[model samples]
Target: MQKRYRIKREKEFQEVFAAGHSKANRNFVVYQIKKPGQTHYRVGISVGKKVGHTAVCRNQIKRYIRQSLLELSDQLPGDVDFLVIARANAKNLDMKETKTNLIHVLKLSQLLLEAQAE
Candidate 1:
């Protein structure tokens, strides 16, 4: 994932977690904050340690989420900051499945502009 696309700062993450509203489905939790902006949609994916204790497992899930996001990043609106939080199910899910599920959640939450078929 590109550095500019990610929400890297601790303070930014905290503000999103605390002030942003979220909607959860079976596979992922979507937290979104709308910042009036002209460029870039800041995004972050968080998979909790409770989901998996091992580093390999956690990294794999993060990798899957990151890859999925990279594919759809261009379609995301510029003024919104999105945080995708993976659940325990993320550890075992495949790239295609995660992407399908994430797109579904994004649509249901009315966050994404494009239509979701899955």
Candidate 2:
């Protein structure tokens, strides 16, 4: 994902956590809030030490999660700030499974912009 589409500041993350709504599954907790007058979606991904003690492991998890979101970015709605937080169980998932799980959760939360079958 591009830097423009990422949530980089501590205050932004805190705002999303405090005001956004959330949804969770076995692997991820997703928080989102609609930002009025914005034109794009901003994302944040978190893979903490609880999920993986080693830095490499945590970074790998973050990479895969961001990759998954990148693939699904076109389908997501704009003007939203969203965060995906990894759970301990997320360590067991590979890139493909991580993408699948993340997509499923996004769909469940109705965050993705549904494509019309024309």
The whole-model lDDT of each prediction reads 0.83, 0.90
**Model 2, range 1-118, lDDT digits (tens) per residue?**
7899999999999999999999999999999999988899999988889999999999999999989888887888888999999999999999988988887788777898874222
Q: Write down the worst ten-residue block by lDDT for model 2.
A: 109-118
What is the number of backbone collisions in each predicted candidate, taken in the order shown? Answer: 0, 0
**Against the true structure, what is each candidate's TM-score?**
0.91, 0.94
RMSD to the hidden true structure, all candidates: 1.5, 2.4
